[model samples]
Target: MTDSQGQTPDTRRDFERFYAASVKRLVTVVYAVTGDLGEAEDAVQEAYARAWPRWEQLVAEGDPTPWVRTVALRLAVSSWRRTRNRVRAHFRHGPPPDLPGLAPDHVALVAALRHLNPEQRRAVVLHHLLDLPVEEVARQTGSTSTAVRSRLMRARRVLSAHLTDSPDTPTAGAGRPATAAQPRQEVLPHE
Candidate 1:
């Protein structure tokens, strides 16, 4: 098949090969972005579907993985935004039912994430948690490298302060030195 871009798109055999090669990596990126396995799978599938018609354009550009990832992340973010509104409405209307098997530490971590503004959280996750270089993050986020670096610096400072002040940390007067038993788990939004 040829695409509007006047390039020969992938044939059935080519698509099969591509899917077999790329699905796992694409899903991993989606999972990192969405933080929900089910949603990540759905989003990645959707992106793959969209990419199908544009296969020629993608193949011509060489390596469609990044394009697929961008689409998946966008879809995941859209879904998250919609769900967030529903959650807010549920909170306002009535008491929420308890979720079972939710660890307190996990709850605390989510709360800590909520404390950060979205950009700061994204910067922290993309850089520190994902181990992406500043340039890559800047490219993904459409920001200058310097801006990404600045945001990462600010995020680290804020996170450090927040962790240090948490009740889990020991005070100077305590016989033992203050250190969290388990290091905080960082969620990388883009990996």
Candidate 2:
């Protein structure tokens, strides 16, 4: 009845079977309630870990799911509350100040970068400033290398047009740093 450590083999096997059959479905239900895959996964895994030490009792008392589900859902609610509070605290700091620099042109370049969409800005910074390859950048951003390359190309055209001191720069961006919210067409000339 007992294994090397005096734990019953039947109890361990039964718990393993129950876990294999239920974990994915449990996570799906928890994700529906939590609306975040990562959070749901964390909560459900923690619940299962907690249940392991109590497996014999849980299994003998009928289905162990209700116990695990209740614990996981409660943890999800706690996680949501913590996240909401952190967001509120961050917004209280107000918007960040504009990027600073010694040279006006450098400042202007940094400002122009702000106008790019978040994905494009990341592609430029990671590739050009950090000198990372396109494949590495794509890996960091969870995108394919081809998509990252395209982003870098468009970003370069946009940045090159924005960074120049020529007449195009003065008229195109109006001597102001770009914000991420600006439309790309506003900065790019129509072909």
Per-model TM-score on C-alpha atoms: 0.58, 0.42
- Please provide, for model 2 over 5-25, each residue's C-alpha lDDT reduced to its tens digit, 9 standing for 90 to 100: 455888778878988998886
What lDDT score is found at residue 127 in candidate 1?
Answer: 73
Best by lDDT: 2
Q: Give the TM-score of candidate 2.
A: 0.42
lDDT value for candidate 1? 0.65
Model 1 residue 117 distance off true place after TM-score fit, in angstroms: 4.4
Q: In model 2, how large is the Cα lDDT of residue 177?
A: 31
lDDT of candidate 1 over 1-191, digit per residue (tens): 65564445436558768989988766755544444556769988999889887776787899887688778778877887879875456434432235345465543343444445556666666676567788988898889999988887776666555444345544433332224344667998986
